[model samples]
Target: MTAPLPSLRARVTPPDAVSPAPTHGHPPLIEVDRLSLYYGAARALHDISFAVPERLVTAFIGPSGCGKSTLLRCFNRMNDLIDNVRLEGTVRIGGEDIYARDIDVIELRKRVGMVFQRSNPFPKTIFDNIAYALRLQGLRRKSEIADIVEQSLHQAALWEEVKDRLHASALGLSGGQQQRLCIARAIAIKPDILLMDEPASALDPLATAKIEDLILDLKQQFTIVIVTHNMQQAARISDATAFFYLGELIEHDATSKIFTNPARKQTEDYVTGRFG
Candidate 1:
């Protein structure tokens, strides 16, 4: 039998609480207002608006090529890597406009970490994989680095499995272990927002379940945004869900409502497995 769904605490703030004035003293952690993106002459996203609250899991779900990954990349300005990619309107993190000229993209990315679909661990040892980011920031204390490596691995739920093999090559790990190691690496810097782009898509079922459990556990300390095509996984893990269609935000609401009683007919049909 399937395990019972975990009791969902009321952590999602209402849409009105995410007003521009910051009502209830809880400002949104990330805000996208009338945001549009383009790759040279081709527009990818049109006028999308949403607010992601702190310390919660928000998921983006839709059919393939619906701009879910595109919008997730905008949170940390990953689109900047694409030639002539342009953004209109604003994407603000921690009340600071990320698109502003003076903003430091490197620091912005540090605050907003990401885990990609595949497990792309470095060729170095497991300990070095987790230490790579900390070392780049000029942290030289050996004791501190060791402590952080253990702490991050524990947070990612991999410490017990790999503690004895910290010196082993990361490339030798199983696919699931490598993916968890990637998560530990991302969390090592203690980012406030973690963006996952189909992070479990390449994993097996057991590995995917472990990643889902990690996502559920990590929300107490970090805000998470997940882009997923797996409807069941979205419903199981996310506190809130957003449905995108052809680069537009078709609907967004609580995960339960989105799955059971969506306000839009399109969202209902899609959730009911009628059509994407």
Candidate 2:
């Protein structure tokens, strides 16, 4: 078997330790079993099953509307907010079904933060943008919020650029900065998992590179699942990659395997630029 990518394994495991994969016999942090989803009458995902390892970067790569983002939303239950959305089967985080009765979505959101394709900083100061989620959870102490804000920004690799102007309006920053600020805001609440949907699709190459680097750094503390059409980006940073097609999971495996020797003809075709 191919070894785990060093950059990923080194972040959360000791050197010489076996990298985590379900096929490798390591238990997964997130489990999707025979799961299907529908938006009103239109089915979006069909019987998808996969296990995501903890503290590793998992990339979902496919063409647009191929159910990559749909599955990413399942991790945090974002689909629940949309009307007429229906799901069959189970999505389990830490072995507990998130769709089960009495699950506190607010708290679930706190544990599973999301960053959108577009940079969305509230029309507030950068400081407030990062502190909003904390405040909503009743963190009123200015010192506490300030500490977390600084830490999260550092984690997102934006603190150095904005530390001197944190109180300024978030809208004043450039597009890349705003995206990093959004990431900082998401991490400020210290989520256990992060779901990013084409987060760098709107940024220029430089900004996209920065976001990619930040993602590499983040896996030390959070399990990250990203939806991207950029096949190269998925290969660059993810430990595992899942390919979706027409609301079905066509292939999922280690990133190196998927990119280098994909098992499915469709995954091979998509990754090789034959078709998307």
Candidate 3:
């Protein structure tokens, strides 16, 4: 029989190996250099910066309204959708400035997909939900679409559970299954980075466990960035963790160190439940 999938712990690299700068290894896949964001007169993120390695899970963790989610949206420029928003500095993916005047927002979003806290499946069949994104990208052949739909579902770890009822309505699935369907749809277009904002916050314990498992398997293929308020969950899945507070990035390092021996008193307080 085929070997079972490895657990999350099996995939973690030691803390010493995780570094902010290039240390005889591949350069970061995503780089944020002194980035700051403002909503009108209110600054949502101060001068913040960090680098994210490819094919690993990097999590942003902090208390509510701490700008973790705001920074996550900056990766794909999701904040541009909001009115009166201004930004400074640079966010580069693969060394290209994402905010450059020549960049195409539509194509950028295609390369970097997002899954929100609440699962949102189209009001269509499970097969169609996955196929819809492919069609939007101009893949019209039924055979090609079918193949991609299957591949995406398998990547999201939902193919076997729904293969027999591909035509069934996605709305009929449980909250957890709907979230997985949304994940499958996001990957159907073959994006390089996956941004998850509190992806498991809406699910029960069992479903949350499944989502965490899927994240572990997915990091082998795609660069994953997530924003979560759950400190324990961050310790469990992330290779590196960044602690944000009051719009600033307070500390960023290997997940193990951030949890056990964070550099800042503020970070320690937040993680240890002394204060949010």
TM-score for candidate 3, residues paired by index? 0.90
> Candidate 3: which stretches are off by over 4 Å?
1-26
Tens digit of lDDT per residue, candidate 3, span 188-225? 99899999999999999899888899999998788889
Relative to the true structure, how large is the alpha-carbon lDDT of every model?
A: 0.86, 0.86, 0.86
On residues 82-200, what C-alpha lDDT tens digit does candidate 2 reach at each position? Answer: 89999998988988899999999888888999999999999999999989988988899999999999999999999999999999999999999999999999999988899999999
Clashes of 1: 0
> For residues 1-276, could you state the per-residue lDDT of candidate 1 as single tens digits?
111222234333233323232112434789988888888888788777788878889899999988999999999999999899989989999889999999999999999999998989999999999899889767899999999999999999999999999999999999999999999999999999999999999989999999999999999899999999999999999988888887877777778878986766667778889897
Residue pairs in candidate 3 whose N, alpha carbon or C atoms collide under 3 angstroms: none
lDDT value, candidate 2, whole model: 0.86
